[model samples]
Target: ASYSVRRVVKKSKRRYGRKLESQFQHGGSRSLWQGLRTITDYRTPSSRMVNADASLADELNARFKAADNHANGASGTNSVHAERAGEVNTFTTSEHDVRRAFKRVNTR
Candidate 1:
């Protein structure tokens, strides 16, 4: 039974290694990244975790509200006023400009 288990494990490892190599060879950079992630068993960390109570949410809300208040205080300069002072309030575009922009883009 132990010999069988070892054989199975060896076979699985060989198969996985082959697959990873193939991914790196023919898959380009994206496939290479995927292969690396697979090798490392990589997973994106969750942005938020489940909470048994609402205290976490309440704390986050309070923090965000405090930050908002601080940003809006008299010591903080309004972005809109700064933009107005820079004299870039309006945006203008033309069909020719659009065509030129599109022409500059690579189709591939």
Candidate 2:
């Protein structure tokens, strides 16, 4: 779940970064403040001026909780069968494993 959340966030940031880069490259704003304002003042369809981070966090939390409930509601026998069906369907990595992998890569 954490991995899924992190992957979503990373993709979102990359997409937003590309958007900002395109805006700066083509928008032809004369000043840094103008460019910043263009980026900051832009509104999406569901844009809100306040508590955006909190709202996004709440939404993601709800989504994750729903997914957890759905997964947990699976019958034990069905879940066992599902687990045996494929290794790719399982989340095999732990936080410790990620940390150790990072450490090894950094040391090298």
Query: RMSD in angstroms, all models?
Result: 13.0, 19.5
- For each candidate, the alpha-carbon lDDT, in order, equals 0.78, 0.71
lDDT tens digits by residue: candidate 2, 1-108: 999999999999898777667767886545544656676785447746565678788899877766765787853334655666876565689999999888888542
Task: Supply candidate 2's per-residue lDDT for 96.
Answer: 100
User: Which 10 consecutive residues of model 1 have the lowest summed lDDT?
Assistant: 74-83
Residue 56, candidate 1: how far off, in angstroms?
15
Those runs of model 2 whose alpha carbons end farther than 4 Å from true positions after fitting are 28-108
Model 1 accuracy (lDDT, Cα): 0.78
Error of 1 at 29 (Å): 3.9
Give one digit per residue, the lDDT tens place, for model 1 in 26-91. 757687787688767989898566554688779998777667657767245555456679675578
Q: Give the Å shift of residue 93 in candidate 1.
A: 51
**Which candidate gets the maximum TM-score versus the true structure?**
1
